[model samples]
Target: SGAVHFTRNNLSAYIRSNVRYLVALLVAGFDPSSGPELHYIDPFGSSVPIRYGGHGSGINFCTPIFEEFYKPTLDKRTAYNIIQKCVAEIQKRLVINLRNFDVFVIGREGITKLDPINQVSLRAQLMGNPPPRK
Candidate 1:
């Protein structure tokens, strides 16, 4: 349903909270043989993949959906859609539970954020429609 934004310095804290507060899983895609690839790690001290990854509540429910939907290697378009869908699902859960939640996406290009102001616009784009029928 939405996305969260944070600076690199806060990444550790974010990972810690996600592990502590929710059932978290990391879905990553990477080529280890490549020189100097990136990796993601959580509070549990597990690290893997790089090109693409995510963690949060309902991850168990959503991951299989992603797996089936995701390609082994993704182009930018595929990666963007996958991430947008994942975040939208998280946002839906947060709204249904009346909980406030945030999501972060990290990559070699750095992080892209969808905070309060632009989330709606971004979501609209993700859904492949013009912004809501307002």
Candidate 2:
């Protein structure tokens, strides 16, 4: 919670100083005493706790997928699979192309980084399209 407040303050100060840029931040982690935490910090530095959230241009595309699929008790494999599904949906639906993504898992053990996913490749797999030629 302190971290979230600090981030909100920093963002608020930055926006106050620069007035020309808008940015939102997502802070997520695993807390030992409390389990999982996800906070969406808006451009004005207002922070809201959320179970599942997305930021920036892809939020519209990703949020619905998350809402439809997210479960608090998801296992690692299921969570990763849902992430892939979200990415695939975004690639297919969004106007701008996003090529790759880095995935991390925050859990009881701590943050675990996974192999990055190439959105094009994953989209092809999800959609039954041919893979990019090697």
Name the runs in model 2 displaced over 4 angstroms.
13-21, 119-134
lDDT of each: 0.47, 0.78
Q: Per-residue lDDT of 48-97 in model 2, one digit per residue for the tens?
A: 99998876677788888889889989987677777787877777788987
Model 1, range 1-134, lDDT digits (tens) per residue? Answer: 00111222244465667543322334323233442244554444444544444454566556766777776566545555565566566666654442333343344545544332136656568567643221
Q: Report residue 122 deviation for candidate 2 (angstroms).
A: 2.2
- The window of 10 residues in a row where model 2 has the poorest summed lDDT is 125-134
> Model 2, 118: alpha-carbon shift in Å?
1.9
The clash numbers for all candidates, in the given order, read 3, 0
Which residue pairs in candidate 1 collide? 1-88, 1-91, 4-103
What is the lDDT, from 0 to 100, of the residue 109 in candidate 2? 83
